[model samples]
Target: MKFVSWNVNGIRAAVKKGFMDYFNEVDADFFCIQESKCQAGQIELDLPGYEQYWNYAERKGYSGTAIFTKHTPLSVKYGVGENDSEEEGRIITLEYEKFYMVTVYTPNTKRDLSRLEGRLQWEDELKAYLKELDEVKPVIYCGDLNVAHTEIDLKNPKTNVGNAGFTDEERGRMTRLLKAGFTDTFRHLYPDTTDRYTWWSYMSKVRERNIGWRIDYFITSDCIVPAIEKAEIHDQVLGSDHCPILLEMKEF
Candidate 1:
């Protein structure tokens, strides 16, 4: 089946900026979104053949995530735990008969690295949560994880060293996650590919210069690696600082 993930920045704004067009064109079986910035009833989206699920932050117009899926999930979960439920509506887990699908908008470490410790804690908690779920069934996790995994994941890794998202601490968490039986679908497909990215800086001429980070991803249990049909970055699609990422696989 076809699955797509995008950090729309703001769902309301993206709808007005050709989100519908891209949505129709892609026509994925599951459309996952992060940074929706809207609560239930705040916006209306008339997407046919899709079941909508959203987790909104208590604060207005902040971090939020949504899943639009053609198949109905057996269960839906909002956050990992009560502690993480407080700030940053970051995760949404959809339980299907065969696998659990999780979409996350990982908390970003502030430019000054002020939130690094919290982000690290989140990584620990998130990995524990995923492992707990994996014990029951395989998982398909996707989202804007807010970290450029390696030097190949960003435009200028040398200059970005020790920065918030590129810090060794942040990248180390990702390493631990993958080591814990998850496979980054994109890298699994094209390990040596370079110059491809998903999130771009909104700074002056950054997107134009293609200075961006491949922070968004689709990761699945190691057992499902053979089923990954395609993992792609739709960099040409626009509307937010991050473009859309696609992960196609055979239906379980």
Candidate 2:
């Protein structure tokens, strides 16, 4: 099976910039996207042979997520609980016979870190939610988690240590999540690989320099680690600040 995840920044804008081209080229079994930034009835995508499920933020052109899958899910859920995220539409869960697939757009802590406390609470709730689902079935979680996990994840870790995406607090939540029986499929396959990233700053010439962070990921239950066939970063893809990531695994 092939899975693809990308934070398109804004789905509407991405479409104008050839989102459909990459979408068609990838032809993923499950195409997960974050930061859709669109509301219902705002945009229509012409995608045949795929089931499109979207969780739109209450506010227009804000945080949102979607998953285009070839398989019909047994159940589909939006959000985790009654909190800000429910309104922001940051998560979507599709339940299948074998596993539950979750796509998320984790709340960013803001450049000033003013939302740090709330963001941490979000992590705690997310961890609990993933664990609850894991108790019932293995999970395949993928999305733009909004954090650069380690020094190697970003270009200049020393200068970015306390920044929003590279903060210690944010990285710790990821650590806790992995320790709770999940494996980051990319890292699990290539622990020492460097200079590979999924998200880049839209700054002057950041992407041109390849100075980016591998914030987007494909993570699965620890038990499924052995099934990971290929985990890759499609850094060459255009249309968003983030690039697409691919994960090929044994059919479960």
Candidate 3:
């Protein structure tokens, strides 16, 4: 099965920029999107063979996530059981027959690091949520996690060390999550790989220069390692600061 995740940045804008064309071309069995920036009734999509699920934030035109899958999920859930975090519509858990597919648009600590505390709190809650779901089945967690993980995950680690997304605190949270039995599918396959990134700065010619961070990911429970045949970063696609990341597995 081909599972893909992308941070469209805004659903409305993305659609206008040939999202449909890319959608058809990629032809993933499971497609997950983050930073949708839209609410119910705001937009309509006519994806022929896909079942759509969306979670929108209470604040209009803000953080949101969606899942488009060819196969119907046995069950679906939104939020992380935390009231404030739930308000932003950042998380969606889709239960497939063999695994749980979770898509997230992780909260960004502002440039001044004002929301760092809140982001950390969200991480804790999310870790708990993943652990709970893992008890039943392995998980396929994918989205714009908003952190560059390690030095290798970013283009200029030295320069970005304490920045909002690369702060030690944020990276530590990600470390804790992975240590709890999850594997970053991409890095797992290409350990020590560098320069390949997902989210790029919109400023200047950053994308052209490939000055970006590998903040988006496809993570799974350790047990599913053998099933993950390949993981990729589709840096060519544009419409958002982030490009779509791909994961090819044996079967869902």
TM-scores for all candidates?
A: 0.97, 0.97, 0.97
lDDT of each: 0.93, 0.92, 0.91
What alpha-carbon RMSD in Å does predicted model 3 have with respect to the real structure? Answer: 1.5
**Model 2 misplaced stretches (Cα beyond 4 Å):** 81-85
Q: Single out the weakest 10-residue window by summed lDDT for candidate 1.
A: 79-88
Q: 69-172 in candidate 1: lDDT tens per residue?
A: 99999988887855435456889999988899999999999999999999999999999999998999999999999999999999999999999899999999
For model 3, the superposed segments whose C-alpha errors exceed 4 Å read 82-85
User: What residue pairs are clashing in model 2?
Assistant: none
What is candidate 3's lDDT per residue for 1-252, written digit by digit as tens? 999999999999999988898899999999999999998999999999999999999899998999999999898899765442477888888888899999999989999999999999989988998998899999999999999999999889998889999999999999999999999999889999989999988899989998889999999999898898989999889888889999999964
Score residue 206 of candidate 1 by CA lDDT. 94
lDDT of 3 at 3: 91
In the predicted model 1, the residue pairs found to clash are: none
TM-score, candidate 1, is: 0.97
TM-score for model 2?
0.97
